[model samples]
Target: MKLIETIPENFEVQIQKITGDNFLKEKLESLGLYKGIKIKIIKNNKVDPLLVKVDNRRVSISKGLGLKIFVELL
Candidate 1:
């Protein structure tokens, strides 16, 4: 399932394990995504950036990263 499909508030899901270059993984981690961490899709930004909340901080998810992140609603 896509990450954006998850309901807001008290959401938790493991990020789809992905294999990529070290640079890419580090970049993703910097955006607050890891194997066991849960993220919340706080709000949708169709034309602009996709806003998300992780570790109680708001972070923006780009279109490319959004598509790569597969998550199940829990």
Candidate 2:
């Protein structure tokens, strides 16, 4: 149920686990990537970072960090 496993777009999930990239992890949390928060993968900018929606705000996540977060689709 990892976030990366979710489809390219159109999915909402709760963050279940986060691993690797310590600095990225902290940054994600600061941007509202807590366990209970729901997130939606808006799109993956192939040439750049992944864009996601958190608390009605858009946030860009690095590819490395995106690969480590496990999410349960809701």
Candidate 3:
């Protein structure tokens, strides 16, 4: 598994785990990020927050937090 922030745009990944404490995990889960969910990288420019498609909605995730989301390429 790799960090979500490292994947290029237009790639899809399946969440394997979110590495963090319950508070962090809960925050991510509330944004539709969790194990078994499919995530698409829409934009990931180093300067700006990452843009991702989750649960059919577009969401921006910080590079710092994105690194905590572990996934496998699909």
Give the candidate number with the greatest TM-score: 3
Candidate 3 per-residue C-alpha lDDT over 1-74 given as tens digits, one digit per residue, 9 for 90 to 100: 99888899999999999987789789888988889999899998878998999879898888788878889999
- Model 1 over residues 1-74: C-alpha lDDT tens digits? 55553435456655666445677778878877776677777665555566767788887776665655666665
Residues 22-63 of candidate 2 have per-residue lDDT tens digits of: 787788889898777888888865566778899799988777
Model 1's alpha-carbon lDDT is: 0.65
Superior candidate under TM-score, 1 versus 2? 2
Error of 3 at 9 (Å): 0.4
- After best superposition, candidate 3 residue 69: deviation in angstroms? 0.7
lDDT of each: 0.65, 0.77, 0.89
Q: Rank the models by TM-score, top first.
A: 3, 2, 1
lDDT of 2 at 16: 85
Q: In candidate 2, where is summed lDDT lowest over 10 consecutive residues? A: 1-10
| TM-score, structure 1 vs. true | 0.66
Winner on TM-score between 2 and 3 is 3
Candidate 2 runs further than 4 Å off? 45-47
Backbone clashes in candidate 3 total: 0
**What alpha-carbon RMSD in Å does predicted model 1 have with respect to the real structure?**
3.1
Candidate 1 shows a clash count of: 0
